[model samples]
Structure formats: structure tokens, C-alpha cells
Target: MSDSSTDNEASLHQYQDIQYSLKQSNRKTTSLFIERDGSVTVRAPLPYDMAKIESIIEQKRSWIYRNLAEWEDLNRVQVHREFVNGEGFLYLGRNYRLQLVDEQDEALVLKNGRFLLRRDHVDSGMEIFKNFYRTKGLDRINQRLTHFAPKMGVTFGSVRVMELQHRWASCTSKGDLNFHWRCLMAPLAVLDYIIIHELAHRLYRNHDAKFWDAVDKVLPDYQRHVSWLRHNGAGMGL
Candidate 1:
């Protein structure tokens, strides 16, 4: 609960329950958030006083370096995908490179390590790309859902995709499945796990052992996919 400000310095504010550290992230950010569930985070350059930051946390009678060390460990498990040339894009477990090409098609093309799309289709170019991926990705997921849902002893009324800021997927009590379009960036196994997880809710609707057992009945290696999402799913905009 410490706050410090200076006209010639960056503004610094500390919270009592923050579980994060100062970091030099490659992404553009100014505030960090650590979830109450033990996720450490960082906010990039804004305004701050280093001495005040130390003092504020110290007044809590907590170990200064211990918090820093915890942040280091948490950072090791964070995954941030850089929107840069030659960086790999994951779609259904396949890797593709982002390539800007001149074409009237205005769609995504997967060919030979490239995800080619129209270079100047809209004002917000990234939004166009995201939509392209979302459409195609939903098609794939729906196709798989149609194939697997029946086999897994579940039935869903519908499957839809939307732009969600926080969650990857959710299920309605009425048996509809809603998934985040960003899931297009995760591996195929991870995508399946999410779909199955939500579909399982059509029967159980809660995270009890029986629900997990239902999931395991379909995806025996569900734990691996869960860990994969925990470690790498954030890069997919989670």
C-alpha cells in the first residue's frame, strides 16, 4: 500500500497483494498484474521510483529478494508470442510463418511455411488477419467437434467463436460451446482438450472428479495438454 510520485520521475504505485516484479518485456505494456492464483506478471516502463517500490514492499515485512525470486520463476513459465517476421504461428498444432503478400483474395493461405494474406485490406491490418484466422480456425474446430462429440458421449446444441478478452472457452448449461478465436494459435491437442472440457460440462457442469474422469475417458493424455496450455497458452492471447 505505497504510492510515490515525482514530477521529474515516473509514477510508482505498489499494492499490498501484488505477486509480480519489474520486467523489461518486449511487448508494449505499462502495468503488470499478478493473479491471486499465484501468477506473477509485470507492467513495462511507465513511471516509477525504485527505492519507494522496495520500501513499500519491505514495510509489509516480506522478503524483498524472495518476491523478486518468485517473479523470476513465474517469468520462466510465461509465454509471449512476438508479432515479428519469421516468428512461427501455431494453428491446429502446425507451424506457419506470417507473410504479407499482395493479393485481392484477402484471405489466409497456408503454404510452405507461410500464412499469406492480403497486405492492405483494411485500416487495422491485424484485425483483418485475426478475422481470417478466426474464420478458418472455427471451421476446423467445428469440423472436429462434429466428428468427436458424438463419439465422446456428449451432445452440444451449437459451437460458436467470439473475441474474448479473458477466457479461452466456455460451456452453457444448455449445451452450447463458446470458444475464443485466439485459440487458433494453440496446438491441436490443446484445442481438442478445451473442446472436450467444455463438452464434458454438458453432462457434469462442474469441475469435480467425475467431470475430469469423463474428460479422461475421452482424452487419456489430458494432463499433458493441460500443462501445455498452462505453460504456453498465454502466447495465444489467453
Candidate 2:
């Protein structure tokens, strides 16, 4: 995939400097987010000026730099795993060891405190793990959405588990929800945070004050989960 993001840099307050990629969109208000690759992206409505863009980034300097540092620190550590006996795999916030079997009855299954995978699946351990997450995650995510959607005053559409690279979850404008299978690795509370985060988007589309206010209504301590994901997201992959 090629990134079409271009860098936008200008002067800042008190001799500080902010450089970011400006993505003009149909949305109202300016929204800034740091990408997984450590690039800054700012989305603003069209017909905006450079001075205005700089001011918006300036106002959120603390947030920008704080998350930038978090991004840098996240990529500093690496998580590697070999699909052998006693090797650990994360599921629903706990590490479960792989228990490979010599039967080809199925691709993957979790039973009796271990991830029971067929011996032939060893070569494609990543796919086996991904399948485990998708098959299991679909059930868990739907049940949770049914419980939380009513409180949000919104009816959720089809909830699917997939490979949503670079994002935890996404809610389509049409009311459907899609969650990354990797999200099944996080704790239940963190999973709820991801669910509530997307459901809130059905009401407020941007990360503005009103958008956060919607999220705060459900999960007041959402920041902790956000921090957890930011710091530990790199390790979530297989």
C-alpha cells in the first residue's frame, strides 16, 4: 500500500514546531491522529488555510506529542513467537500455550486450557491463529453489542470480525460494525472500550468534545484502555 500523505509544516507557539499531513475531508472541524507508521494526519474541512491548520495542531500539541512518543515507544519493542510446545498465544487477555495435535480433523480449536491445532496447521500458524480469533470473536462481539447498543440508543447492524489492519474497529456510516480479529487478544474491559468507541461513532463521527462526551457517558475511564492499546498494540499481532 502506498501512502499519499504529504507533510504540512509551519511555525508554532513559543518557538515550538508542528509538522503533519493535511487530509481535507467532507467532515466539519479539524481532527488529528497519529498513524501506526508514525506519521501525523490532520483531517479538516475544505477551504481552510495553513494558518488555521497550524493553530489546530498547536492547540492539541500536548496530545500530538504525547501520542507520538507513545507510538515511538510502541515500535521500540518486538514480539516474536515460534509455534512449538509451551509457546504462548494471547486470547481474551490471557496467554494460552499452543498444543499441537497430529490429527487433521480441523484447523483450530481451543479446549482444556490450550489452543488445540492440527499438526498440518503448524506451517500456517498465523492463519490458524487468525481463524481462531475470527470464529470466536464474532460470537463474543455480537453478544456484547446487543448488551451495549441499547444503552447507546442505537441499533447495530451486522457485526463482522476481519483483518482490519491498522485499526481496532470501525463502524460504517450505514450502522454496521467491523472489528479486527486481533482485538480478541485484549482484556474484556479493553474489548468493551473498543466496542463502545465504535458505537459512539454512530452518534458523533469525529473525536471532538461532543464525540468524547458520548464515549464518556458509557466508559468514563476510557483513557486507560486507550493508553493500554497505544502502548501494547504492537504485541497484539501474531
Candidate 3:
């Protein structure tokens, strides 16, 4: 739960007429983010005044522009997949070509270096692929959480894989974890980074210095995974 901006009740705001979305929470410090879709979001402390929030946003003006530009460049490769034969689908960061078949035991299956899809299932291809990712996401996220929770010295409640449109993962105050099924499209190393990020939230609710310190202890190289996701995330889609 990296405090990646959530759209829930986020109000439209502006600083010097620079439009952005504002999300206020109990966080101690204000932070800015360029979302995967290149939207500007500012997460501010609950008690902060509008003027103060505007000041921070003003301070980071240069950084915001640099990142938004990079986001544009990265998303240029955004994927638009079709259910037809020879179309490619992403699984674990690898692009596997889709092959339509008249007969298959399942709606979709990754077999022999390609994705085989039942031709009749093509109309429901989006849902079928979503189900495939969710099934795989649950298993892999659980396995990684089990392996890392002990190392991070934390216990969690239930874990679920679903459509988390904005963030890759989130955790409840009860310590239950929820991951975006799209996460299954990431490489193993990036998936682990997302796991550790949310699990660290069990120890600290905010992305403060101490919270990042916990993540760094486990994954000193985690920044590379972050870069990978920011650069390639747009292509991991239906």
C-alpha cells in the first residue's frame, strides 16, 4: 500500500491553476505522484491547510513535469490486445502469442510457450483472461507474502486478487492484503517488490522515511523494480 493515490472521493484542486487531484489522509508528510496514466496527485496530511498543500505542489513543479514526460514516453508502447490468433498476451512480463483453437479443455492456458484460447471463448476473452490472472495472482502473491512476512516479521490476514484499477496492491487496517490481478503480468522480482511494499504498511501506515527504511532492509535493489513497473506497466493489459 504505497499510498499511491486513490481516486475515491479525491477532489479536483489546483495550485497556481495547475490542476491536480488532492487526497488528504492521516499521513504526516505531503507527497506527490505521477500516476500510471499521467495524472498528477497530491497526498497531503489531514490537518494541512489548502495554502500549505499548494506550497508543496508548487515546490515540486519541476519534478512533476519531468515525471509526466517520462510517463508519456513509457506509455507509448501501451498494449491493445485482441482475442484473435497470433495476438500476444503478457504473462509474467513475457509476451506469449495467442492461438485460437476449436477445442480445448479450458478457456485459456499457457502451454508450450504460447497461450491457447478456445475460439468460442473469444467473445468473453477479457473476463476469461482476467480470471486466469486472478487465479495465478492469488497463488503467487500468497506464496511471496508467506516467504517475506517472516523476514519482515509481520503476520497478515486474508489475501485477495482482484481489479485494483489504480494501485498495484493495498492493505487494510486489519492487515488483510489485496492485490491487482494485473500484478500477475509483472516479472517475479517486481511482484516481490509490490508484496514487500504492502507488507511494510502493516508496520507503518505512511510512506515515511522509517517505512521506506523497512522496505530497503529487505530489498536494497527494490528501486529498480519500481523503475521497471513505471516504465513497462502500460503494456501489461488486455
Error of 3 at 6 (Å): 28
Give the runs in model 1 whose Cα sits over 4 Å from its true position.
Answer: 1-87
Q: Write the per-residue lDDT of candidate 2 for residues 87-147, one digit (tens) a residue.
A: 8999999999988899857887788899888888799998878888998999999988988
> What's model 1's TM-score?
0.63
lDDT of 1 by residue, 66-133 (tens): 22221223233344444445656677667777776777465556777787755664345467657766
Question: 130-158, model 3: which lDDT tens digit per residue?
Answer: 99999988888899999999999999999
Models 1 onward score TM values of 0.63, 0.72, 0.72
Scored against the true structure, residue 120 in model 3 reaches a CA lDDT of 90
**Poorest stretch of ten by lDDT in candidate 3:** 66-75
Clashes of each: 6, 0, 1
Ranking by lDDT: 3, 2, 1
Q: Over the full model, what C-alpha lDDT does candidate 3 score relative to the true structure?
A: 0.80
True-structure lDDT of candidate 2 = 0.76
Give the range of the ten consecutive residues with the poorest summed lDDT in model 2. 6-15
